[model samples]
Target: MKKAIIVGSAISVIGLMLVSCSSTPEATTTTTRQTTVTAAPPPPAQTTTTTTHMSGSGY
Candidate 1:
């Protein structure tokens, strides 16, 4: 009974080590996109002028 128990434990530890060393690393991926936007038109401009004349002195 003692020999059988020692053999079983050794076999279990070796199996765990083999399984841990056989694993492969994972891979990753990335994606990107571009977009364009249009600009709005400018507002209209206005101009106004006024003139006033007064006659009071002659020399």
Candidate 2:
């Protein structure tokens, strides 16, 4: 019984060491970027008017 227990314990310790010391694959990371654009406001409206009157002949 004692020998069996010692053997079992040794095997368990070796298994744990192997599992802890093994190398794992590196993880991959992805990055995303976002952009936003805003349009400028239109200029205000403007109006101009001109009038001319002329008198003809003699008065």
Best by lDDT: 2
Candidate 2 lDDT for residue 26? 60
lDDT of 2 by residue, 1-59 (tens): 99999999999999999988785656669666787888888877776677777868776
Which numbered prediction scores highest in TM-score against the true structure?
Answer: 1
Error of 1 at 42 (Å): 38
Model 1 earns a TM-score of 0.40
lDDT of each: 0.81, 0.84
Can you tell me which runs of candidate 1 are displaced by over 4 Å?
24-59
Judged by whole-model lDDT over C-alpha atoms, candidate 2 comes out at: 0.84
Q: What is the lDDT of candidate 1?
A: 0.81
**Ten-residue segment with the worst summed lDDT in candidate 2?**
23-32
User: Candidate 1's residue-wise lDDT over 1-59, tens digit each?
Assistant: 99999999999999999988777555657555677777776666666667678888986
